[model samples]
Target: MLQALTILSLLFLTDFTMAASEDPAELGAGLQNPGYEELPAWFKTSFLDLTEDVAEAAAEDKRVLLYFYQDGCPYCAKLLRDNFTDREIVELTRQGFDVIAINLWGDREVTGLDGKTTTEKKLATLLGVQFTPTLLFLDEAGKVVLRLNGYLPPHRFAAALRYVAERHERTGERFSEFYVRTNPREAEGDLHQEAGFLAPPLRLGDNRRKSPRPLVVMLEQPVCRECDELHQDVLRREAVALSLAAFDAAIVDVFSREPLQTPDGRETTGRDWAAELGIEYTPSLVFYDTQGREVFRTEGYLKAFHVQGALDYVATGAYRWQPSFQRYLSARREALAERGIQIDIMR
Candidate 1:
């Protein structure tokens, strides 16, 4: 089954080397001795000139893919090792786009599409790059047509590539819509039900005015393997369940046209609201504060630990002071370690 394969792949991802060492001589030869992130050799060696890079790729009748990464990021390693090694994905990438890597915290100078000059880190900030492996797919005009905020496994990542490569956005169809229409997977037959979720005839705006708890809108599809795992494995954990207790949770089928009141009091269908929120990944958990403002969200495939962390991050009102989820995760892990508990992200 796909769910079994997904879990199996995640287990292998835990073996990535994170030890500190000098950068490898040949990047992307698999995880070399060095601990630093290794990009695929096929990634374009560029001068970080966005304007020129776009033009050059356009000349070759290809689009541009800007890969933003950080050193020692496990997901980035998974992307390079797992996704890039797929012959189909590699060939599709080579045929359609010029892939360029940009270090999220590097000091290398970069020229922006707006003709402004900035360092890699500064440009990342300017572009609101909050997660590693954030991919920006640009059109010939240097406009980002699609932006992926975190790592996606090969299947979804390939769909993303094809979406941009075929210029689906030019037809006025969002990537999320296109993906749903093209790729339909087998599921457990129905949406997973949770006791914590709000009852139907869902009026989120009205509920927010009555309850003081934060709200979490889970956007999922019936035909999703990850969604099945989320409900079957991740949510069943005690810590994860406890964290879920702090919020008023709601689950919506992203492809459904069923009407519901949004947290901001807008009447819209689940399908429309999902497209508005850019819900590209199934089983995306979007968290909002008590006042109806978005605080944080997790859109990638994550295990129980990270899921619990995201819940605690919002439930504890930590986002008020800590804007960086990665930093908060680090501090959370260290705090747990002091109590003689070792947390594994893939677990």
Candidate 2:
């Protein structure tokens, strides 16, 4: 009877150990296994070059939460498996912040404000981060809003997010105001103020030859939230604006009665032209080659880097030699990656 009891106990213990090992969420008190369903709607998984972009986002009322992690960092993995994967935290992050994950030991290069370049590991050291899983919160102007060292529990992390969000809601007060009040700077000009607009108007088609460069028609509606966001945020930047100046650009309001001539020689009002283009969204970029042939079209908002890549692809005719647009995009990414410039693929 004793031998039988011992055998049964051993079997039960083995089974329990196997179950726990298989379940990542059960491995620890706070840790939870991640799944696609658990990912926050607003948590952008798209990889982006966060170095310069963070500053620009601050100007647009977007705060950046930058997570520095390495491959074998258990704490970093725990945060991903537990805190970030939590449904509530994911939802909250989606609503409030633009999150970026950086490999701290990565070999990627980052450009500094003074035009100097350094590796990701070197940059981490310069930022005074001594450990993995450091979270740096920056306003749209690239000012450090908060810095959290070591692992943060889900509850405390949520609280930190709330604190930042509440502080950000006070519009009249700039990030510089709060930062300078606490840590005074000798510099007079606001760093946040220098964060320029993303998109600007084209030079009204100066590059037009007997064969024009290309025509990029933007379909916009007055009160469209996405349209307004793109116009004010992505398109207003100097780089984007200058690139756009090389093309014949026009913004047509969908409700307008202004006449437009289609590539097919058919004349119609701007409203009808929008309908013919099958543009259901307020902000859509329709690209036409020199001969007025539709090369490509992208609907919705795009960030600066992706937008730049897309423009470069179409302008240089890179698509003609590539297998597909997707492949071309991959090649572009690899090229940029080689130069240590990361671009958000989602955009």
Top candidate by lDDT: 1
TM-scores, all models, native as reference: 0.50, 0.39
C-alpha lDDT of residue 155 in model 1: 72
Cα lDDT tens digits, model 2, 1-347, are 99999999999867654442233434487664332112223454533556555655565566788777764467776576446644346656766678866556555666643456786677788888877789988765566777888887655666667657666535666544545444421211111111232123222223233435777777665534455456667777787777776666667665456665664456677667876786655567777787667888777456676676667777878767763766777887898899999866655
Q: Tell me how far the alpha carbon of residue 65 in candidate 2 is from the true structure, in angstroms, after superposition.
A: 37
How accurate locally is residue 130 in candidate 2, as Cα lDDT from 0 to 100?
A: 76
Q: Where is model 1 more than 4 Å wrong at Cα?
A: 1-186
Off by over 4 Å in 2: 1-211, 344-347
Candidate of highest TM-score: 1
Candidate 1, 151-179: lDDT as tens digits: 88777788899999999998999988988
Q: Which ten residues in a row have the lowest lDDT in candidate 2?
A: 185-194
